[model samples]
Target: MATVTRTTRADAPERSRTEHTGGGLRGAVAAEWGKLWTTRTPYVCMAVGVGLTAVFAFYYGSIARINDEPVQAVGKAPIASVILLQFIVVVLAMTTVTSEYATGSIRTSLQWVPVRHRVQLAKAAVTGAVSFVGGVLLGVLGMAVAWVPFRGHASFETGEAVVQLLSIGTYLALVAVLSVGVAFVCRSAVGALASLFFLLAGLPFVLLGPGSEVLRKINDALPQSAGDHFMTGDGDPYPSLVGLLIVLSWAVAAHLIGLAVLRRRDA
Candidate 1:
């Protein structure tokens, strides 16, 4: 009878451990979501992004309407917004992890979750989802608001516009994920953001500046330059697939490095 009681007690602990292990990632994801919305930063950033998008869309749309250039207005409206919105997305993404690090909450979080990778994955997932939604929402809103300036006369190539919209949203999500990875590796918001800024915005200009043809060719291969073709209308030299692969490579590499760091370091 004593042996049977001991066996049952040991099995109970094993069952509890198994249950927690199975649901741990899910719990982390939920915690990430909760943490993200609890702050004012995300809301403020989103509002600023949307506001800028609307203002730019209205200005461009008015010009197109006066010029009687519906196609250009319809096509470029959302994209113009995307250009400015990327900065906001970067901030939101980096904050997802950096905030925890800044406040030293990461140590407590690690203690609770234990699996570092899952925590990173959860943060990335939440950031990606939020950025994707915000990108798409603002893109569509910009388009709709721009159409008002056109007074129902603006025409769009529906299929192409749809594709571009999807591509823009997905691109923002990827950038957000990349930012989170960078934050994890750098563990400092300012450092991570500055590095990403150079990677996404600054380096492209330097590479494309007056220089050798080799430098020009290298510029075309940069993630920013390559990704610029994603939502921009036609006549790009680089294939869409190539552009996607280039940007995706950056995001993947950052996350891989971050994962390695997380595994090797103490939270």
Candidate 2:
């Protein structure tokens, strides 16, 4: 008779660990991608973001038409709506990380990924890609809705509109990465959201009042301000390229800091 072997509980965990660790970055990314779409929050956030974009576009576009405002640049028509709806993007990204922690699923994620940095990278990659696609769609939808109201009052330059849409996508992608980093650092939805809210929205207004040149300079460098400059093709305090660089720098810095925290902490 051939020798027969029985598997024990202890052997099962080791086998599972080996299996999970074998896939490396590809596995981590695939796991994150599945986790992102396998929930209701992402869908809700996307629907709400799209709904708000339409509402804001129609409201602002109607006002512009009724007021008979001067012919506006088609590329800039969605800027305001995008800015207002950005928090939705933040919430979506934040939830990707924080919800795992909330549900105690992060432990399982860490077990599967093992390398914490890879997990962070995977989350960032997934969130950024989704945000970029969502941003582009939002840009297109906002412009189309606004165009209906603007009718003959909008100047359509294909090149400018294309640039603006791509810029919106890039900007939102960076914002999503930044939010992921913050979420990793905070590990709590409320903490990350409050921090990002202050960084993206509140701080700018606080510093916008008549004050020192230093405060004004700080305001110009803030991520949202830089994003606005880049998206709207505005060149006042700095060029759009410079604005893009500033946002990129912030995202990188946030990622590094979050990676450090992840490395030092327990799951």
Best by TM-score: 2
Taken over the whole model, the C-alpha lDDT of each candidate is: 0.82, 0.89
Cα lDDT tens digits, model 1, 1-267, are 355435567698888888777368888999889888999989999889879988988887887778866355375787766767888989998988888889999998898788888888888899898888888788888888888886655677788778777878888988888988898899988899899999888987787677878887787776677667766733467777777777788888888888888888757
The C-alpha TM-scores of every prediction are 0.87, 0.89
| Residue range 1-267, candidate 2, lDDT tens digits | 999999989999999988767388888889889988999978998899889988888887888889998998765667887777689889989898899889999999999788889999999999899989998898888888888888777788888888988999999999999999999999999999999999999999899886879998999999999999999888998999999999999999999999999899958
CA RMSD of all predictions: 3.0, 4.6
Q: lDDT value for candidate 2?
A: 0.89
> What is the overall TM-score of model 1 with all chains considered together?
0.87
User: Could you tell me the TM-score of candidate 2?
Assistant: 0.89
Q: List the residue pairs that clash in candidate 2.
A: none
Worst 10 contiguous positions by lDDT, candidate 1? 1-10
